[model samples]
Target: MKIKAIAAAFAATVLTPFAMAEDQSDWALVIHGGAGVIERGQMTAEREAEYRAAMHAALDRGEAVLEAGGSALDAIEAVIHGMEDDPLFNAGRGAVFTAAGRNELDASIMDGATLNAGAVAGVTQVRHPISLARAVMERSRHVMLQGEGAETFAIEQGIEMVPPAWFFTERRWASMTRSLERLGLDLPERPEGAPELQGVDHGTLERDEREHRFGTVGVVALDSDGNIAAGTSTGGTTAKRWGRVGDSPILGAGTYASNASCGVSATGTGEYFIRLTVASRICALVEFQGLNLQDASDQVIQDELTAMGGDGGIVALTPSGEIAWSYNTPGMYRARQTAGGDPVVGIYGDED
Candidate 1:
């Protein structure tokens, strides 16, 4: 009887928590800052700790929302918003420099249960691009808005607007200047005064080059109610010209969500991602092809990115509470929290 009672008690203690956790719908959340050349040696212990703290803060914000029964969309937006406001990860306040030496922000959000999406691109005045994206998704009929029009819509919707200078940073400006100088040094000099073309001084003239150094910020969340959502934000590309926009504000490219499958947020080369539909493709592969979330993410980030001649990474969470992360670069800043309260966070690729 004593042995039987001990066995029963063990079962009760172990199984009860699992049963309750399963009953709660098994919530999970994941976030990423971007993927790039991150080496373990390059990141000092202090820097790594800072990155981890930021990631945890973002996760904690989202977890609170999920615990309080907030919709997955809300949780995702809140978490991403935190990153956007921080200057560390290069989304909103810390966006990269554009060709014109300015910052142009982009963001998107999606609700998996309803397929509702919102996006804003080339936004200069909005204080929080993600908030504008949510407004576009919920208040406006359009899926995306750009430039002054998007700003106008944001103003009408009561979104906080800031000056263009609000997006500037000294590091970004210095980086842009250095990049232009380097590009000039790499170009071959033409014959001395041969056909002095109007406005064509290849060596002296500085052409705007976009900064591809930083990664976008994103969140994927599964709430207690079994709903999933994803959100993404970016500063576009550093030193980009001709109003070039990246995958961040484009649905299915940088952000995607589906109630039947999962929610995904991507950070990498924007042009390649847009062509391959990286975010949506991951969800489709998992839902339709029966691939696990990790396998699907790997296929998309590795196979798909290679096929498209692009590289980057993604963070995802499925409705069944599985976490998926994949990156082809040397590193991607990411974090996760399981329904069981375990937390994992890292910046370098092998930091696990």
Candidate 2:
């Protein structure tokens, strides 16, 4: 081809028109349901459609907040609350059962403007743990509260409380049983009045099984005011033992935000995330190393995590509204919306 023809081809790709949402809006947002072995071949059409719809709803909800001139922290809080209400992903209503046959939730939130953050862990009463996390950040001096103490603070703050049974769902219960069986955990005897349980195959653990034990839901957003924020919540690993609290509530592990660099929310095996300080590490890469948002996110999720025998993903946003995400797994439930385009949501590796 002639030089002019090649130049024209490149221009065409660069100058393609997009469906803009607002004229003066200068904001962006992205959310993730989780990252695991979510392959298209293994998902039924109905299931895929369900996930896509949920992701779109989350993106739109958060984008609406930003378009209305809401704070980036508000957008992330609202987006994460909606996912926690939906029983589809393991965060709020769909949290997995622990080895003790009960629900224990963990959540965290961050404000990039002042490095303010709050976290709550092993709280079973709060319907929206993210809100409790924000309360801890804004209402108190502490960065984290755990178990009954967190619940007490939430109750004191007049946060809406739910019964433990409210989070019980058939899907999460089944996943818990399967994980227990794989780990050879002996269950209590089936009583005469109890229903007979059916055996289920939860699928393969694959390489890095220890680090890919479960999934989490999270969000990162940038507002018109140039502030960034991030939040994360999780039901935790299925059949998790000994009151274990994953990185979801850890400020520098599964969630971090910084106006000086970027905001990040992580999902996957929480232990590995904590060990490597994944979320803060990305921000450090951007702030200290002068890497762009995309480069830092890719360096952490794609290269570092994978090399460490961990599998997961993250969504990140810079102060300038640049967005990026990376994952080594087959799929990550993710979506993004900005002023210049409509929402884009995907689940499988091919979609990425």
Candidate 3:
């Protein structure tokens, strides 16, 4: 009789902690607006303020969702929607022009709880590629779609569509022209019906804005239900050609999430991120190698990615509400917020 009583008490002790852990109100969200050689000297004070304000607005959007018990997927998608509309970041409207003088965007989304994912690449007309990616995950059997086919799918799914000209930004066009000139290639003709460049003072990209040509925007979140979700969006690299698809639309490369491991959204040199599987590789280190989120991120970004000569960074969130980020570049535009905690934003590498 005593043995039975003791067994019952032991079982209760072990099970109680798990139940409490499940009920904890822990939630977190992390976001990044590209990474590169961003130094204080290169950024004007006005430009810096604009970036910080955008990050704060994004955090507020996501925080409201999580605080209201929204799913991690919804929270991140909401945050990314605002960034996609804002020309301050390079995802949707401000996307860089390709070698063909077109804006070919790519994006991916993953739900950690189910391991379901979707992606779209080389999409030109979708207003929000991230939303299309999510639609693919929920409504289609395929994992990825690209180009005209993806646009057709977006239309069939009632995803918002925009004229290609709507994506044209003078800054991105100037950057593309300069890139082509440097490559000693013939300049591309402007797309049909492109709006005339207006209110642009400089024809050439400033040093600080040079890296903006390679920017991407991403988000990773862990909700109160302990589900993790990650999403990434980009306009590939400036002057990309041959229907090039970067890591942003590739699952397990630039974007990955698994409730058993971690959620990751990466921005960097797409080829290197694709080769190293940077996103999932970091999560693998955490789940399989028993490394904490920070150590796993460091190992993947600082050690392995650096050895491969990759330049960029990643933001990761664990089911346990841990947030981590690592970058090999001079700086990464990043932000984070947890339930009941203040939002913290960073741009320069020197910041903690």
Candidate 2 colliding pairs, count: 0
Clashes of 3: 0
lDDT per residue for candidate 1 within 1-352, as digits (tens), equals: 0001111111345332112233447677889988877776555578567778999999899989987888888888789878877867678887876666667899999999999999999998788899999999999999999999999999999999877767665555555556656556332233232233334333212211221364699999888788889999999766677899999999999999998988999998899999999999999999999987778888888787877779889988788676778888877888887565666777766554
**Decreasing lDDT order of the candidates:** 3, 2, 1
After superposition, candidate 2 runs with Cα above 4 Å error: 1-25, 188-213
Of the pair 2 and 3, which is ahead by TM-score? 3
Query: How much is 250 displaced in model 2, in angstroms?
Result: 0.4
Considering every candidate listed, which one attains the maximal TM-score?
Answer: 3
lDDT by residue (1-352, candidate 3, tens digit) is: 0001111111234322111233455678899999988887787788899999999999999999988999999998899999888887889998988898999999999999999999999999999999999999999999999999999999999999999988888878887887899899899898887887665545226664555645899999988888999999998898888988889999999999999999999999899999999999999998999987878888989999999998899999888766788888888889987765567889888885
Angstrom error at residue 67, model 1: 1.3
Q: Give the TM-score of candidate 1.
A: 0.85
The lDDT per prediction is: 0.78, 0.81, 0.86
For each candidate in turn, the TM-score is 0.85, 0.87, 0.92
RMSD of 3: 7.6
**Candidate of highest lDDT:** 3
lDDT of 2 by residue, 1-352 (tens): 0001111111234321211222323787889899877775666678678889999999888988988999998998889888999987788888888887778999999999999999999999799999999999999999999999999999999999988778877556666666778789975332233235654344522321322245689999888887889999999988889999999999999999998988999998788899999999999999999987777888888888888998788988777666788888787888887755567887777765
Pairs in steric clash, model 2: none
Residue 296 in candidate 2, Cα distance off native in Å = 1.1
Better of 1 and 2 by TM-score: 2
